[model samples]
Target: MSQLTIVGLGPGPRQQLTAEADAILQSGQPLYLRTQVHPLTADLPAFTSFDSLYEESADFADVYNGIVTRVLATLADGPVVYAVPGHPMVGEQTVAKLIPQAKAAGHTVRVVPGVSALEALYASLAIDPSAGLLILDALTVTPETLQPTLPTIILQVYLPRIAADLKLTLLERYPDDHAVTMVQAAGDPDVERSETGPISQIDRLGWIDHLTSLYVPPTDETVEYEPDGESIDGMVRLVDTVAYLRSPEGCPWDQEQTHKSLTRYVLEEAYEVVTAIEGDSPDAIEDELGDLLLQVVLQSQIAKEAGEFDIDSVAARQAAKLIRRHPHVFGDQVADDSETVLVQWEEIKATERAAQARVLDGVALALPSLVRADKIQRRAARVGFDWPDVQGIWDKVAEEVTEVQAAITSGSKPAIQDELGDLLFAVVNVARYLNVEPEEALRQATMKFTERFHRMEAAAKAAGQDLSAITLAEWDRFWNAAKGR
Candidate 1:
């Protein structure tokens, strides 16, 4: 049976290399070095023979497999020493691959632990592994795959060839100028930890070697990789990110934006979110809802900067209002059905407002006229003042429509305005009798008319006729044809 001893060579100098590892390397057995780039490789004890098949293999796994093959073939009778950089248990990929392979070959594998890069990193960075530490390979994974619950150091830089990839992956979750360090040869006097510029400048094909690594200082960039099991709230992360974006050090444009400036965007994103939901695409809805949520956070961030409020206040206000309005949910009130729920909600809302002062205050002027009129009429009707039947409202609408026509024929703009207001008000009352939201109904109708009218315009344009040059009769034909009137 073959026996394999995996030895760690510390970070750099022979002084720091562990005694156990030193004893194994000095024994007269076949020796394998994962890499010769270590600063203290010159001082490691002379061996029976030396092999460096690990560093030469372009595919690292191929190198490990070859090593396993050679060791098993040689170990038919004897034992061997395989020396790896740093602690054998740390970010050493060869050791990770070697254990399973050796076991598969019926060979007993022993790991000789030595001072790892993390030991030097912790001392240099003033940290403890138990406090929060994540060791990763810089070549295989991105910073987006990192956990941020504690301090983290990515290892196995091997070469600057992977630096660019790491940098690009890191930039997604970090600011461009985030100060990360390039750690090389930790623990040894040659140990260097340079607080480098943004990750963008690190090169994958440059001077980086096996000893190279990076340190990302703690940030609120929403870490996706949770190495240690911990729950992260997405909403909190989003809120924090938004907070930073609106901060002075964040985006200048985002900082300058106002709630009003983002109004249309909020509306558009909200509608897009609803559309994505209706489309039954969870991924699309997630993306669109994220966009919609951005508006909320962005607005809150702006308000915070202006000393108005932040996301917490925004959430708390909404939550408190919800609790206050939802008596059926949290209070002793009871509502048997949807209609009763609606009635209770309105009653509670009106009562709350009445505690301050009450008038025809159910609707604000900012609402579109038709909608406002409808709500005002409804609120008033709840107090027992409304039309006895739908016909009364219909007659009022006809009378208003007639006055508007008569005023147009008489060519008086002021009279036209008065009659138009009356017609709109009457239509709103009629809409209430029909149990439709007048605002939504009018908006839908307006959109329908707009769609057909655009077709009429396009048709006229295609025929090379200016709208002003076209007579009412010609316009009527195009509009009728466009709408199938």
Candidate 2:
């Protein structure tokens, strides 16, 4: 088989380069360096560099692809030695592509490890990486993708523009005054430089290049989850914790919980999540949302113990349903708008429930009245049982209002209650036609009223007057002033 040898050139010069990597470089085989811009590449034997590809290509992805294509083509003639800065497997996108392609084509590929930037970073910072360290590439990471609980190392921060971008991304999870360390050409004592300052001023440090990496210490007072330890670590830990809680020797309270009994906690966590979102705090929302997910996990665990179904089955059923329902997204169906998509979704659901006798078969009776009214109308509309236009909807509302007045005048309590319910249902229909959630709209309106009433009371107290003693005219004036403010 044809041979491909991938080698690491260490973080900097000859002093940092490993003996095996040095020997591979000195071998007479045809040599290729990812870039000639590195300090040690100048001292290596005569070789070709892919640095020129970076100039000709539009982006790093194109450059990496071009390098892989060129290397594979060269392997057709004879064995080739490919060298890259730092460890080949550490943040080297090109080698990741080359190894898989080479293996699939029956070429034997060898990876020669050398000191990576991570080693130099640890030395420069004098910190123990054994506890928890997250290494990420500067090009592909953003604020949303960052896990801020662990100390982080951002590699290949090779441009001022990238540094500026990284600064902004970090500021989302970190304070502007948060300190960060910049380690350049680590392990080469002569050329190495480390600077520490606020993340906001990282771009101003000057001379960002290929050998640069940024060290971000964990921010103080961060209330997020503990170092997810690793990517799958959190999930594994959650599963284990839940299993332990349900064990015989575990917490008595947790042991007593059944799927049916835990339903209240599920509803409470959902409302808490909604409250956190309304508060507009991302961290609070993230935390509360995790609590909501815990309820799902707990219920699933209980179901598993009862031999009904496991979490995997729950996930599989949900995924299958989503794909089956979203024919436009997962299949070759064409839906132009959300209205068309929803219609198709309802049709798919109807097909799933073909054995049911009623058109409103799947509408949950346990839902809030406003939401339930909306769902009933949606189902009726699907079958062309809806009003002709907005005028018809308004006329229905008027009719319900008049019926409520007649019932009130007749002084029949049950009739009055029934007519009032009809009026509310009609109002919910109006909310549905206007594409609004009646429950949330009413909740917000009630909150506004409460705030205004409190403000009027405060103003009355400041004026040395009691609200109970105020006349109706004076109360109206106070309410209008509160509304104006």
Candidate 3:
């Protein structure tokens, strides 16, 4: 037979206590109360309480562990009734941890339910929880854990310090003047008292104890985690983490970084992501992508601090752009192929920016020269200033190369530099005509050259000759060997 019985004391009122709980307490067996702090305990039969654990322990975990240890030890002798305030399963940390371990160790455990703070809170606040309600334990609460759009009830506000901590956390999401209700001795009509004021004054409510609970009303906007228990892919959690990092209590280095300061990091992370993708390692790509996302979040956090924008605004803008651009996917538009999609996308962009003065007005100056040149030529093509075909582009490349050769023969440095730039631009046009991104093509070409160069170095080392000491002819021999390999 099971020797352990867990029961709730029903929010400290004799009338509110359940018949089963009362019968168990009066069964003439060894009864143990978690604490003697409740109002209903005075009218009950004499029993041992674990109130001393609270005074002697270092933390709540220690106190709860001590209670569990004592309960398990006493259960070895005979059957015992363990009573706690409110429902045994609701905000009862000791019971939550104890029951599972006890049952697994061959002890039979039974729980008798009683009135929880949810019921008491509803009666006191006069609100329906069905609309949207978030129940949380105050001890483990944070701004990220809070769903601000739902009416929230936080239980186990057992100390003034905990209340102050909760108030600070709430201030991160709620305005300082946001109203909150503090209910004490819930469900006990004689001792039940309620106070309403700004959340900032939570610590000053004068009477905070195990029975106290806080009720927070919904805000104007919805929370990231909806009240329906659905998770939105962790975007909200990431946003909240970035916000906390930019807060006054956040890291000093993170707080000092502005949008301009983070630009270099953004560029570096983007390059790393490209490298990772090219390496064909999925784990590396995922890690590099996370780093790139950090740069975006950091910039948004800085912008939010300046009162300019936030992650949500950035996401909303991109979402709207995607919906607008993909008319075939989101609207009644037909695009049978990738080429048609590109044409429609460009047309949509042109219509959106009809007031632009120049064709290249939207092209960023910070883009790589090759990519910027490609964009410029594409934009110019839309305005009727491009080659008619790939042959024309090839001819242009040949003409630019001739000009560069003539400039070099004449020994004019400036003319040579100008002609070389024109040659590179012509090559970019050729790449574009071949339906390849010039910058990406160049990057791949460079990586291939680097691999061949390293192979040549390794061949030189295997031949017991350093490349620096070898002649140009010997270098060519190793280079040719690496090429053939």
Candidate 4:
């Protein structure tokens, strides 16, 4: 039977090669190497290497596929010995693809393991892998795959551009000034090199090559990895903190709170976030957003204790809803503009609300009256029960204003209230047609009026006159002065 033997070249030193692998290389059989880039390849017996395929292929996948095809074709001739750098099983794409295919072709396969790069890395860095460690590929690094709370080792940082891309992804979770270590030729003392510096300068190192790897230690100030199953990421740490606050040994006020009791705080925090955004201070916005997020985590914790749901489920459900509704982004649906996106969004929402008894049923009644009116008007407009244009809405506002004057002249309290509400609703419709949020517009108007009134009060105090005792003409004068200032 034709035999296929896979051997490891051990990390770069001749001493690290296994005795079993050395015996096979010296057996004078047909020898093949995955690449000739390693230090040990110079002293080895005559062999054929697939290094030329790397230059001819477009990508690593094509190179790996080409290597596997040549190796399997060579195996059909006679017994063969295939050697790859480090351990044959560790990050060797060609070896992984060749073994099963060779076995299926009625060939006996044997793997002789040698010292892997990970073993040499541990010895070079003097770090224990028993602690939490996250190993990632530089080519495939992503925000979702990174865990900054654990000591991470990134492999295959073969090029400067790959390192630069990895640095950007890491910067999302790790600070730019965070310390990182680069190691090259881990076990070979003759040519080994290691450097420690800020992650921001990783791509500037000129000595980086195919053998280089990066090490990022966990940042305790940003996020911590708890061995007791308490936390793994920043969000998980927040969830754990909230869970502890509701525990028996935790805060009394937090332990006594229910979901219903926390509703008011949720609304208050949301409004404070809006106020902070309006103030346009980054620090205030971040703080207020954290406060708002706390409410969500706390409510999720309460639900978890009640066996209802948790934060993970809430986030997953929301993610699913967003992906499902955004077919233009997540699917093949094409939406070129914001208006088209909104139309697609509403169509998706309408399908989700298909079980509802009415078009306006999902608009919460607890929303502010102006916001609720805007939502109600939008819902009606979707069903074609709306004015054709902004001009029609303006005409309706004038008609409602006339009715309010007639009702006030008739001296009917209910009639006046009804007409005033009609006029406000018509105005809200005009605001919606103009693409303005009525609630936010009214809030800005109210704030401006309050500021001007305070200025008028100051003017009255400076003139030694009580505001209540001022005549209409005097009030007008003060108001004009305030406006001018």
Candidate 5:
């Protein structure tokens, strides 16, 4: 295989260029300069007549791609000398592309390292990139894509025009007050470093070029998490966590759960946790919240096992729902008041449910019937299918009760059962109209009745007359006494 040499020209002149790099440059098989714009390139002791031609390219990608093409072409002839400004390993775009391509094409690629911008910048400032450093091409990266990094070296800040664009993009994700230091042609006789506050003002200093690089120190505090799982280095998707929980390698209990099994626990934990939040104990809520999240996590684990959905799907679907329903946040649809927000929400929810073949569906069937009924009734009431007020619902309930009583008097079981159900349904409407949860209200009523019945039993027991043996009149007296009737 033909040898493809990658040579670093250093940040400045031949004096700074390492001996190994000089040997590669003098090899004379064929010399290709990645770019001639660096001060070090112009400072080459002797002009290499066969340097790579890149200046005529319209863009950086074109120039780099062309360099790779030329490098491959040169390798077919024999050995080649490919030179780039700064270290061959540091932010040299052509080398980054060429090294892999040459070897992939069966050509042997050799890298000859020399002084990098990072080395010169570090020495000049007495700092170490080892503390934490990031490098990027000034022509490509936006401020938003940059991870908050320490001792960042932004290379290839070719011209004033590119620097200005980079500055604006930086402002979007970083504060205007972010400090940036510019190092130009470090180690050159005309070497310069400019320290500036405000990313906006840094562009005004415009002596930046292909030889220039910026050093930004570490940004903020880092929060660490449980590292017992997968690679602690990467940004773990929530789905990955769910996958672990569901996988054969994951938790045993979590793997055993199903949607049907988790339903009751989900409801119980959610209500108890919501109660903590409403009770105004943020501390209690925090613990209970973890419990609530366990339910969601466990459910997601089960879904993943079943090949249905996972945590990410659940979160993404809910996130999309909020954005879609609220349109005001993610879109241009205006909602000035709570009323308007609610109206938009209802309309959007209805549309979505209709798409799911259930326009009027408010709650899942898995919910208790009473709570589900209340939710359905409230949703319908918002659109005007409700009693005007509690008084109207009370009248409807009373009317149903009279029908029930009349049915009872007729001594017809089917009629009485039907009428009793209607009376209860009407009572539910009255409870809804009164702004009460019918289920909770009925629970309290039943508990009170049980207590009163126990009081009557106690009073009868104290009388020393067995209730079963007592005359009708005596039993009546004791029952009245017990109940204060």
Candidate 6:
């Protein structure tokens, strides 16, 4: 039977290689090294290394495939030994692809383990991986892949450009000055080197190479899952609190509520958040946002109880959608400005929607009437269904007003209501054309009127008169005085 042996060269020096791995290397069978870049490769038996493939191939995938093809072809010559740095299973792409292909071809496979780079990294940095560790490949690192609160090690930062890109992605979740350690030739006594510095300066280092790996210690300032799972962070604790509140042993009101019963509170909490934002009160904004978040958590909990979906799945879906839509950030597509971003965003959303879905289909029906009107108008405008100019919208508003007046004069209640709605819709279009938010404009107008009415009531009270009993003329006088003030 054909045989293929895969061996690890340990992290560094031949001394670190396991006795079993040493025996396999000394078996004197045809030897192949994944790469000759490791420090101990020179001390090993004569072998062919794939170092040239790294320069010839366009990407790591291509190089890995090329290595696997060559290694499998060599099996026709009887037994073969393949060696890789660190460990055959850890961060070694070629070995992973080679094993299954060799096995399918009826070759017996043997894997000899060696000390992995992660083990070396742990020793050099004096960190314990049992606590919590996230290992990431530098080439595929992105903002979404990082968990700032966990101890992380990024491998294969072999080039300055990769390090630079990794630095930017890390900066999204970590402070620019967060301390990170870079270890090279980790377990080799003669060449091992470690440097500690701010993450922002990692790309500026002069000695990065194929053997380099970075270590980032855990931080508690950010909200993320605890490794032990015994304790919860603020957000997770809130989720637990909501779960408890809805449990049989909890609050009567919370336990009795269903998703449908809590719909109004969702809307109310959202409006309160908007009000707090408009009021420019940070504390109120924080409190109101917490209330709004409760609605989401509660809805997710209700769905979970019904065997639907939980909050984590909800967040995962949203994150996936965001990453998919944002090609400029997560992919290669370029968006130079916000307008370009919006166009790209809509294009991506259009692809996600069903072919028969209308342009306004995704707009929430539960939104305030004015806001809903604005959203509907904007959706139509995107597809060129809008009036050519503000003049046309204004003319339409005027026409609706005339029809409303005629309906009122004819004493037709339904006709009057229909025309009134048309007039309001036309007005909303006018606001859209002028780039104004109709809901916010109406809110401000209503607030202004409320303030003036309050002043009028105060004036009437000071004069010892009841506002309800005041004549129209007196009302106008007080109203005008309040408006003037």
The numbered model that scores best in lDDT is 4
Greater TM-score among 1 and 3 belongs to 3
Candidate 3 — worst ten consecutive residues by lDDT sum?
223-232
Top-down TM-score ranking: 3, 6, 4, 2, 1, 5
Candidate number of the best TM-score: 3
Q: What is the lDDT of residue 44 in candidate 6?
A: 80
Each prediction's TM-score versus the true structure: 0.46, 0.49, 0.55, 0.51, 0.42, 0.51
Across residues 1-485, which tens digit of lDDT does each residue of candidate 2 receive? 68999999988868888898889889889999888888886687889999888778744556889999999999998999999988999999899999999999889999999899889889888889899988888865655467677899999787775686577567656777888899888898988988999999998878788789999998674423333434334654575467568775578999888777887888789889988998899999999999998988888777655444555567768999999999999999999999999889878988887888887888887677877898998778878988878788899999999999999999999999999999999998888888899989987998799989999999999999899999999999999999999
Query: Which regions of candidate 1 are displaced past 4 Å?
Result: 1-232, 267-288, 446-485
lDDT of 6: 0.85
Per-residue lDDT of model 1, residues 55-145, tens digit only: 4553344566676666666777688888877888887666777788779878898988889888888887777778667777774454445
lDDT for predicted candidate 2 compared with the true structure: 0.84
Model 3: residues >4 Å from true position, as ranges? Answer: 1-233, 409-412
Error of 6 at 109 (Å): 56
Candidate 3 vs candidate 5, lDDT winner:
3
Error of 2 at 13 (Å): 72
Model 6 residue 121 CA deviation in Å: 35
- Write model 5 residue lDDT over 1-485, tens digit each, in one string: 89887888888867888988877666555776765666656545444432344446533455677778877887888887888777888876678888898899898877888888777877876786666667777645644346654556777676665565566556544666777777777677666656657676766774765666666555663222334534232223343455466555688877666677788898999878966875689899988987888788777655543435555567768998788887987899998899999888878877776755443554778777677777877777867897766888888888998999999999999999999878877777778887899988876687677777788778878766677788889877776775674
- What is candidate 2's TM-score against the reference? 0.49
- Give the clashing pairs for model 6: none
Cα lDDT of model 6 by residue, 178-228, tens digit: 898988889887889989999899988999998899998877654333434
Error of 1 at 450 (Å): 6.7
lDDT, candidate 1, at 274? 61
Q: Which ten residues in a row have the lowest lDDT in candidate 2?
A: 223-232
Give all candidate RMSDs, comma-separated. Answer: 22.6, 20.7, 19.5, 19.3, 16.0, 15.6
lDDT for each residue of candidate 3 in 1-485, tens digit (9 for 90 to 100): 45799999888788899998999988888989999988878888879999998778744556888999999889888888999988999989889988987898789999999998789889989989888899998856776678788899999787776686577668767877888999998888888998999988998878998789999999884334343324433555675667678665788988777777888898899999999999999999999999999998888766654435656668868999999999999999999999999999989999987898866798988788998999988888878887888999899899998999999999999999999999999999898778799998889889989999999999999999988999989988999998898
